[model samples]
Target: MPKSVWFLIIGMLVNTTGNSFLWPLNAIYMHDYLGKTLAMAGFVLMLNSAAGVLGNLLGGFLFDKIGGYKAIMLGIFLTVVSLIGLTQWHEWPHYVWLLTLLGFSGGIVFPSMFALAGTAWPEGGRKAFNAIYLAQNVGVAVGPALAGIVAEKGFDNVFEVNLWMYVLFFFIALLTFKRFETDSVVPKNVVSERKRITNKASLYALLIISSSSVLCWIAYSQWSATISSYTQDLGLSLKQYSLLWTINGLLIVAAQPLIAPLVKRWENNLKRQLVFGVVIIAISFGIVAFASDFKMFAAAMVVLTFGEMFYTPALPTIANQLAPKGRQGFYQGILNSATTVGRMIGPLFGGIMVDQFGMMALMSILVIIVVIAVIPCLVYDRPLVKRSKSTTVLE
Candidate 1:
C-alpha cells in the first residue's frame, strides 16, 4: 500500500475509535442512566442512523466538489464541536441532539476517508477498501475495551475520552491528509448511464444481494442495541459486554490467517460462502437465546464474528462483480444504502421485539430471519445462469 493510503487508514482508525466509544454504549447509557425504554433508545439510534445516511451522501458530494482533504477536515471540525457539547451537557434531549450531530458529522468523515483511500491507491483495487475496513475493526477493538474501563469510572469520562480521540484524529488529518493528490470530479450524465443497464441478470442479482445485506446488518446491529442491554440485565459487567465487541473486532483482524485456506477454497463460490455464513449466524443466535453466562455470550460473539467474516465482505464483492463498467458507483451505492437502511431500522426493530415479545422471542425471530435470508444468496445468480445459457444457444 502507498503511504497516502496508510495515512487515510490511520485517519479512519482514529475516527472510528472516537465514534465507537459512544455507539456501543449508547443504548446502555440511555436505558440504564436516563431511564428511557429500550424502544426509545432504538428510536434515537434510528434517528442518528438516518442522519448518518444523509451525511453520507452529503460527504460524498463534498468530496467530489471540494476534494477529500477539505471534506474530511470539515467533518472532523463539526464532530469536534459535537463532542465538546456532549462532554459538557449529555442529559435527555441534549444528549439526543448531540448524538445525532455527532452521527451526521462522523458520517461526513467516512465516505471521504474511504473515497480518499481508493483515490490514493486506485491501483490497489479492493485492497484499499479492505485496508480501511481492517482499520475500522481495529478501532472497534480498541475503543470499546477502553470505554468499558473508563465507564467504570463514569460515562462522563467516556465522553471526554471520545473527544480526545477525535482531537487527536483532527491533528493527524491536519498534518498528513493534505498530501494526497486526489481528483475531485462531480458525477454527471446519470440519464445517459441509465441506458447501460443491458445486463439485467446482473442487476437482479445485485438487488437480491442488496436485500439480503439489509437483513444481515439488522441482525448484526443487535449487538450494540438490544444485546448490549440484555447483557446488563443478566448482571454482567460493562467490561464483559464491551469485551464481546473487543473479541469481535480482534478476531476480524487476527483470524484472517486462520481462515485463509477456507476462504481460498470458496473464492469463486461466493454464494456457497454466504449460505454457510447465514447458517453459522443463525446457529450463533440460537446459542445466544439460551446463553446465561458471559463465557457463553463470548463464544457466541466469536461464532458471530466468523459468520460475518463470510457474509459482510461477500455482499460487497458480489455487488462489485455484478456492476457494469459505467455503473460501479451506482451498484455499490445500492449495497451501501441497503446496509444503512438496515442499521437505521435494526435497533428500533430489536427493541420493539424485546419490549413486546421478550428476548427469547426476539432471538427466535432473528434466527429465523437469518435462515430465510439464505434463499437470496442461493438464487441470486439463477438469472445469470439462464442468460448465459440462452446466449450460448444463440452463438
Candidate 2:
C-alpha cells in the first residue's frame, strides 16, 4: 500500500474512533440521561441524519471543484468546532444542536476521504476500500470499549475523549493528506470507464445500487438504536452493550482473512457477493428477535459483522466503477447519502415499532428489510448496454 493510503487509513481510524465514542451512545444518552422518550430521541437523530445527507452531497461536489485537501480540511475544521462545542455544552438542546452539526461536518469528510482513497489507488481496487473499512472497524472496536470504561466515571469524559480524538485526526490529516492530494499520479482508466454507459445511465445505476445500500443501513442501524434499549431492558449493563460493538469490530478485523477466499471467488460478481451478505444479515436479525441473553446478542452482532464485511466495501467500489472522469467524489457522495438516508429514517422507524408494536415486531421487520435489499443489488446494472463511447443521454 502507498504511504498516502496508510495516512488516510490512519486518519480514518482516528476519525471513526472519535465518532464511535458518541454514535453508539447517542440514543442512550437522549433517552436515559436527558429524560427524552425513545420517539423523541429518534426524531432528533433523524434531523442529524438530514444534515448529514446535505453535507455528503456538498462535500462530494467540493472535492471535485476544490480538490480533496481543501474540502477535507474545511470539513475537519467544522467538525472540530462541533466537538469543542459538544465538550462544553451537553445538555438537551445544546447536545442536539452540536450532534447535528457533528453529523454534517463528519458527513463532509467521508466521501472526500473515500474518493481520495479510490483516487490514490484505482489499481488497488477493492484493496484500498477494504483497508479503510478495516481501519474504521478497528476504531469501532477500540472506541466503544474505551468509552465503556470512561463512562463508568461519567458521560462528560466521553465527550472530552471524543473531542481530543477528532483533534488528533485533524492534525494528522493536515500534516499528511495534503501531499497525497497533490501527488495523485495514477492514471485513470478513462477509455474502459466510459466505454459502456451514459452519465445518466451510470447515475441511475448508482441510485439503484444505493437503494440496497439504504435498506441495509436501516436494518443495521437497529443495533445502535432499538437493540441498545432492548439489551438494557433485558438486564445488560452499558459496559456489556459496548462490549458487543467491540466484539463486532474485532470480529470484522479478524474474520476478513477467513472471508477473503469467498470474496475472491465472487470478485467479478458484486451482486452475488451482496446477496450473500444481505441474507446473512437477515439471518442475524432473525437470531436477534429470539435473543434474551448477552451471549445471544453478541452472537447476533458477530453474524451481522460477517454480513457487512461482504456488503459494505462493495458499495464504494461499485460507485468508483460507475463514476465518470470527474464525478468520482460526487458518485461516492451519492452512495454515502443513501446510507445516511437509511440511518436518518431507521431510528425513528425502529423507535416507533418498538414503542407501539414491541421488540419482537421491530426485530422481525429488520430481517425483512435486510432481505429486501437484495432485489436492487441484482438489477442495478441491467440498463447498461455497451456502446463505443460514453454518451450523455437525455433519458
Candidate 3:
C-alpha cells in the first residue's frame, strides 16, 4: 500500500472507532442514561444531522480556500472539543447540543478527507477508497463490539475511550500532515466545462441517487430502530442486538475488500455499481419484510451485507469522478449531505412505520424508495461511460 493509502486507512480507522461507540448506542444512551424520552433522543439526533449540513458546506469551502490539510485539522480540533464536552455532560439538552457539535465536526472532516485523498494520489483513488472503507469497517466493527462490552461497565467508559481516540487522531494528523500539500490550492483559473450531461440530467441523477442513498440509510438505520424491536419481539437482549451489529460490521470488513476488486473489474462504472447496490439492497429489504425467525433474519442480514459491499464504496468513488475540478470537496460534501439527509429521515420514517405498521411496512416503503432510485441511474449510462475514462487516477 502507498503512503496515502496508509494515511486514509489510519485516518478512517481512528475516525470510525469513534463513530462505532456513538452510532450503536447514541439514541439509547440519550434515552436510558440521560433520562430523555425516545422523542427527545430522536430530536437530538435530528439536530446533529441538521448541523452536519452546515459542516459539509464549511468543510468544502475551507478545503477550497485554506486547503484540505487545514480543513481536516480544524475538523479534528472541533471533534476533540465535542467529544470532551459529550463525555462531561449529564443534562439532556447539554448532551444533545454537544452531539450536534460532534456531527458537524465529523461532517467537516469526512468530506475533507475524501477531497484530500482524491488529490493525494492523483492515482489510485478508488483502491485507496476501498482501503479507507476497509479500515473504517474494521474500526466500526471493533468500536461497537467493544462498546457493547463497555456499556456493561458504563457508557462513560466508552465515551472516555472515544475522547482518547479523537485526541490521538488529532496529534497523528498533525504529525503526518507536515509533508502533505497546503501551499498550492486548486487554481480557480481552469476552464470549467460541464460534461455532456445536461444540468437536468445531473440534477435528476442527483435526486435519484440521493433518494436511494436515503433508502440505504433507512435499511441500515433499522438496526437502531425497528430491527431492535423485532429482535426483542423474538425475545433477544440488547447484547444480542449489539451482536447483530457486530455481525454486520464483520461481514462488511470481510466481504468488501474481497469483492471490491472484482466489482471494480466487472463494473468500472460508478453509476452502475451504485444501481447494482441499490437493487441488492432492495432485495435485502424484501427479505427482511418476510423474515420472522432468527435464521431468516440472519439470511436477510447476509443479503443486506452484499448490498452494502457494492453501494458504500461506489458512492464516494463516483462523487470524486463526477466532481468538477477544484470542487471535489464540494461534490463529496454533497454526497455526505445526502447521507445526512438519509440519517435525518430514515430513522423517523422507520420509527413511524415500525410503530404503526411493523417491520414489513417499513421494509416495503424502503423497497419503493430503492426502486425509485434505480431509474435515473439506468438512464445515465452515457455520462458514466464517459466518466469511466478517468479510471487511471483511481485504478
Please count the clashing residue pairs in each candidate, in the order shown.
Answer: 0, 0, 0
Which pairs of residues collide in model 3?
none
For every candidate, C-alpha RMSD to the true structure in Å: 3.2, 3.2, 4.4
Q: Tens-digit lDDT track for model 1 on 139-183?
A: 999999999999999999999999999999999999998988476
For candidate 3, give the lDDT: 0.72
Q: State the displacement of the C-alpha of residue 247, model 2, in Å, after optimal TM-score superposition.
A: 0.8
What TM-score would candidate 3 get against the native? 0.87
TM-score for each prediction? 0.88, 0.94, 0.87
Among residues 3 or more apart in sequence or in different chains, the pairs in candidate 2 whose N, CA or C atoms overlap within 3 Å are none
**By TM-score, highest first, what's the ranking?**
2, 1, 3
Tell me how far the alpha carbon of residue 270 in candidate 3 is from the true structure, in angstroms, after superposition: 3.0
Choose 1 or 2, whichever is better by lDDT: 2
lDDT of 3 at 188: 57
* Model 2 lDDT tens row, 288-368: 999999999998999889999999998899999998767888999999999999999999999999999998998888888
Expressed as tens digits, the lDDT of each residue in 157-197 for candidate 3 is: 88888989888888878888646643434575634244333
Extract clashing residue pairs from model 1.
none
Cα lDDT over the full model 1:
0.83
Candidate 2 TM-score, true structure as reference: 0.94
- Tally clashing residue pairs in candidate 3: 0
